[model samples]
Target: MEILLWIIIIGLFITSFVALFFPVLPSVFAIWGGFIIYHFFLNSGELTTFFWISMVTLTAVLLLADVFTGSLAVKQFGGSKLGGRVAAISVIIGAFVYPPFGILALPFIAVIIVEYWQQEDFLSALRAAIGTLIGFLSGRLAEGIIQLIMIGWFFLIIWS
Candidate 1:
């Protein structure tokens, strides 16, 4: 039973990673949900209430991060709102097509095309595309760091 729950957590972790590559999905909270399951079922023997509260808190933080990370990055990096919207749509499309890399490429391509169409300036379009690329990359990096921390917490709970 514990092993089964652990396996589910592992699966969620993998899904979260896959989500990170896709633009529309939020990876951090998904993995955080997996953590909630793991802590509540597998390794949550000693402090059930504490684990639940912690899980909720973590979920809230990750949710906020997911919501604002990209938009904030876009503006900070000089991408226009329209270009960001295009990139976001591309992300959803990418998810249905292929995995990982396919998803990652969507925003980059979408921003480039749409920015060029809207601005008619090759250099400006390129800058917008670059901004989206950097934002996505940085967001993914943050997701990865969260995953690592969750992994560490998971191991600590199960092994210790």
Candidate 2:
């Protein structure tokens, strides 16, 4: 029974990793939810202090990365503070509306819209929007790598 529960937890972790790219899923929280199940429900023995600390720390880091990268992307693209704010809101809206592509598209669209509104120039808006896209993609790549590492570490802990 514990093994079955563990498998389910692991599955959730995997799903969370994939869902990290989408704004709607809150990937760090999803992974943490799996741990919550294991800790509160299936865990038969106390986890090591090191294990607990690692898990919590990693989750917090991922959450911070999510917020920081997005805002940084806006700043990197030469966006105004208002643009960053709109990008944040667009991320929330993008998560629920179209998904996957929408996750990537909406932020770009939002940045471009705001940039154009502020700059009143198509070329400048396009440039900043492209920058936002590049930064966003970089962040996504980093998140994917981190999620892979986290999942790999989890597997090591479970199986070893």
Candidate 3:
């Protein structure tokens, strides 16, 4: 029974890893969940309570990093709510239409085109788009790093 549970946990970990690339899924968090649950309930290990505390804290940071990143960037670029929402939707749609690059480029391209259309000013629209992209990229990069840390924590906890 314990072995079966471990197998289930491992499967979730792999699924979450795929979410890392797939945008639509919350893969990193899933991986975090697998490690956290296993370490707390099943894995015969040391510092179980402290480990969970650190895991929970790290998970909070990981989630927040993803959420605030794009908006912060958009704000820096002087993008409005309308522009940000539109850009965000475009990114999701782009994920289906393209892939990783599609996910990444949709914001930069979509915001530029839309903002330009709305304001009829090339330079201003360009600024907003650039800001949106920069913020998004930074956040995405941070998310990747957080995911890495979480995954590392998972493995180290499991192995130890």
- Best by the TM-score measure: 2
lDDT of 1 by residue, 1-160 (tens): 8778778878877877777766456566667667678656755574356655765666566556655676676677667898888776776787777766665677887887887787788878887877777766776677677667765665665576
Candidate 1, pairs of clashing residues:
none
Model 3, TM vs. native: 0.79
Ten contiguous residues minimizing lDDT sum, candidate 2:
42-51
Q: Residues 26-117, candidate 3: write the lDDT tens digits.
A: 66667766775676678556537776788778778877876777777777787777778877787777778778777777878889888888
Give lDDT per model, in order. 0.70, 0.74, 0.75
Q: Tens-digit lDDT track for model 2 on 78-104?
A: 777787777778767887888877767
Segments of candidate 3 deviating more than 4 angstroms? 1-17, 36-47
lDDT of model 3 at residue 117?
A: 85
Alpha carbon lDDT at 21, candidate 1: 66
Strongest candidate by lDDT: 3
Task: Give the distance in Å from residue 60's predicted Cα in candidate 1 to where it truly belongs.
Answer: 2.8
Each candidate's TM vs. the true structure? 0.77, 0.85, 0.79
Better of 2 and 3 by TM-score: 2
What TM-score would you give candidate 1 relative to the actual structure? 0.77
